[model samples]
Target chain A: MTHAFYVALSYAASGIVVAVLVGWTLLDGRAQQRALKELEAAGIRRRSAARDQAEKKA
Target chain B: MSEPIPAIKKFSDLANPTIFLGLTARIVPFLAVATALMFAFGLYLAFTTEGDYQQGETVRIMYVHVPAAWLSMMCYSIMAASALGTLVWRHPLADVSAKAAAPLGAGFTFLALVTGSLWGKPMWGTWWEWDARLTSVFVLFLMYLGLMALTRALDDPAKSARVAAVLILIGFVNIPIIKFSVEWWNTLHQPASVMRMDGSAIDGEFLRPLLVMAGAFTLLFFTLHFLAIRNEIWRRRVSAQRRLAARMANRES
Candidate 1:
C-alpha cells in the first residue's frame, strides 16, 4: 500500500481503543445486570422499591 | 374525558434513574446504528478523497486526529455541564453523567495524542512536541484520569460527586487554553482551520468527509455515554439493594 506504517498504526490503535471501550461497557452492563438479578433471586429488594409497592397497595 | 397523564412528563422526569435507563435503552441502539453507517460512509470518503499536495496520504490521519481532538474537548465540556447539574440543581443523574464521561474523555484524549504523534512523525519529523496545544491536551488527559481516580478512591457517592464536580469545574479553565493554544503561542500544531470564524480554511473535498466522520464520532460518544450511564444506574441499584439486605439481616440478628 501507498500508506506509511505510522498511518496504519494510527488506525489500528484507534480501532483497538474503540473496541475495548465498547466491549468493556457491554461487559460491565452485563455484570451489573447479573448482580441485580442475583440479589433479586436472594429476595434482596431496594428499600425504595419496597416502599413504592407498599404505597401502591395502600 | 382527559387521558391519564404519564408519570414522566418533562425533562426533569428523566432525573429518575428508572426512567432514564428505560429511555436510554431505546435510544442507544438507534444511535449505535447511525454511528456505524456514518462511519462507514466517512471511511469510504476518507479513502477515496485525493491526498493533500503538501502532506500526501499522511493527511488521512487528520480524519481521525482532528475528530478525536475536538471530542476530547467536547467530552470535558459535557462533564463540566454535568458538574453544574450536580452542584447547582443537584440533579440525580448529574454525577452519573459526569462519572460515566471521565473514562471516555480519557480514551478520546489518548486517541488524539497517539494519532497526532503518528502524523507528526511523518510531517513534522518529530514523534512528539511539548508545544502549547500538545501540552495542554496532555494535561487534559491527566485531569480526566485524576477525576476518575478521585471518584473511585472515594466510596461515598454524594461526597465523591461533590469533590469531582468541583475538580471538574476547576479543570474547565484549561479548555479555553487548549482551544487557543496554537494561536496564543508558537506551536508546531496548526491553528483552527475548519471551525474558524471566517469560514473553514479547509477545501470542500476534505471537509465533507471530515464532517461526516465528526458526526459519526460524536454519535459513537453519545451511544457509549448512554450505555455507560445505564450501567451506572444499574450498579447503583444493585449496591443499594445489597445495603438494604444487609440492614434487614442485622435487624433480624
Candidate 2:
C-alpha cells in the first residue's frame, strides 16, 4: 500500500473517534434532559426552584 | 420586600451547577462553531502544505498525531486541576468535570496511540514498539481507563468523586514521565520537536498546520468537556428529582 493510505487511515481513525465522542455526549445529554423534563412535568420540582418562585411572588 | 437577587460575581459561583449549566448553554455553541471553523482551516492547511523533504506525504499524519498527543496530556492536566478542586475546595462540579474528562482523555490518548502507530508503520517499518515514550503513553491511557473504572465502580457519586480525585492526583506523576521519557531513555519515538526550550524545530510550513490543528483540537476538547459536564449535571439533577418524587409518593401513601 502507498504511504497515502497510512496518512488517510490516521485521519479517518481520529475523525471516527471524535465523532463517537460528540455523538455520545449529545445523546446522553438529550436523554438526561428528557428525564428531567418529564419529572418536572409530573410536578416534581427542585426545592431551590420552588423557593425561588416563592421569593419572586413575595 | 423580597431579598435582592445575587448576581454571578465570581468564578467560585460557577461551582453552582445551575449557574454552570446556564453558562454552558451560552458558551458551548460558540465553542462548537469555533472548533468547526478551526478544523476546516487546519485541514486545508494540512492538505495544502508541501510534503516534508524526507517524509513526503506521510508528514500529513503529524498534523493530527501531534495534536492528539498534546490533547491527551493536556486533558489529563485539566483533570488534575479538577482533582484539586475536588480535594481542596470540594467544588460540586469539580468531580463532574474530572469524571467527564476521563473518557475524553482516554479517547485522545487512544487516538494518539493509533495515529502514532500509523505514522510509525510507514516511517519506521513497524507497527509496534516497546520503547520509553510509547510505553509511558500506553501507561497514561491505562490511567485514564483506571480513573473511569473508579468512577463507575462506586455507586455513591460523592464517594466516587473523592476516590477518583485521589487516584487522578496520584496518577499525575506519570504525565511528566511521558514528557521526558524520550529525552531520558532510548526510544523509537522522536523527542520533542515543536515544543522545546530552545525553540521549535519544525519548519514554518509544517508549524502552521500543526499549531492550527492543536488550537482546533484544544477547542474541541473544551467544547466536549463543557458538553459532558452539562450532561453530568443534568444526570445528577434527574436522579435527585427522581428520589424526591419517590419520597413524595411515600409521604402521600
Candidate 3:
C-alpha cells in the first residue's frame, strides 16, 4: 500500500541520520584518544631526559 | 589518581572533565541499544499498519514527521537545560553538552521541515506554505544555527560558553511560541490530533508506531549526545596539551 512506502521512507531517513552521527562520533573519539596517547608518551620522554640531564650535571 | 574522599566536593572537582566523561561512557551504550531496538519495533509496526480511510497510504508519513518534530523540540529543551547548568554551576561538561546538542538539534529541525514538506505536498497539494507553525519552526532552525555559530565564533572557550548560554536561554522563548502557533493563528498546518484535551483524533493503528518512533528518536538523540560531549571534552584536552607543548618549546628556544 501507499502507507507502507511512507512508513519505510521515514524509518530509512531516521536510520541514516543515526548511523552517520554515531559513526562520526566513534571515529572522532578514536582520533582524540590516539592523540592523547601520543602527547602523554612525548611528555614522559621529555621528563625522563630532563631528569637524566639534571643527574649528569650533579 | 585516587578518588576524592569527600562526598561533597568543591565546584572545580564536580566540573572535572574526566569524571563527566567516565559517566557518559558508561551510559551511552545502553541508550544506543535501546534506540536501535525501539526503531526496529517501530518500523515493524509502521510497515504492517493499514492506511487511513481518508488519507490512504500518505498517512504513513505521520510516523516520521511527527517524531522528527517531537525530537526537534526535545533537543532544544535539553540544550536549554545544559545552558542553564553551565551558567549556574559553571559545569565544564555543560558547555560541551550544549555545543554538541546544537548540530543534532539543527539536523532534527531540518528533518522535520523536509518530512513535513513531503507529507504536505501529498496532503495539501503544495510543497510549501507561510503558515504560522511553519514560520515558527523556521525561526527555531535559525536559532539553532545562531547558537552553533556563536559557540564557534569566540576564541576563548569560557567566554564562548557564557555567550552561548545566553543565546540558548533567549532562543528557548521561541519553542513555546512554535508549539502554540497553530492555536494562535490561521494556518495550513493541521491542529493537534494526538494532543487534544478530549482524545486523539488519530486512530490507534497510526498512533502506535508514531509513539514508538518518537521514543526511538529520543533515545537515539541521547546516545549521540553523550558521545558528542565525550569527544568534545577530549578535543579540548588535546588542544590544551598542544598549547602547553608550544609554550614549552618557545621557552626552550
How far is B135's C-alpha from truth in model 1 (Å)? 0.4
Q: What is the Cα-based lDDT of residue B139 in candidate 1?
A: 100
Which runs in model 2 stand beyond 4 Å of their true positions? B1-6
Question: Candidate 1, residues B1-253: lDDT per residue as tens digits?
Answer: 0112236789999998877777886688799999999999999998899989998888888999989998999999999999999999999999999999999999999999999999998888898989999999999999999999998897778899999999999999999999999899999998899988899999988999899989989999999999999888888888888888889899999
Q: What is the DockQ (computed on Cα atoms) for candidate 3?
A: 0.36
- lDDT agreement with native, every candidate: 0.90, 0.93, 0.82
Per-residue alpha-carbon lDDT of model 2 for B184-239, expressed as tens digits?
99998888998899999999999999999999999999999999998998888888
Q: Give every collision pair in model 1.
A: none
True contact recovery of candidate 1 = 0.80
Model 3 misplaced stretches (Cα beyond 4 Å) = A1-12, A44-58, B1-14
How much is the lDDT of residue B86 in candidate 2? 94
Worst lDDT run of 10 residues, candidate 3 chain B, spans B1-10
Clashing pairs in 3: A3-B57
> Interface RMSD, all models, one decimal each?
1.0, 0.6, 3.1
Local error of candidate 2 at B102, Å?
0.6
TM-score top scorer:
2
Candidate 2 chain B lDDT trough over 10 residues, lowest sum? B1-10
Question: Which structure among the candidates has the greatest lDDT?
Answer: 2
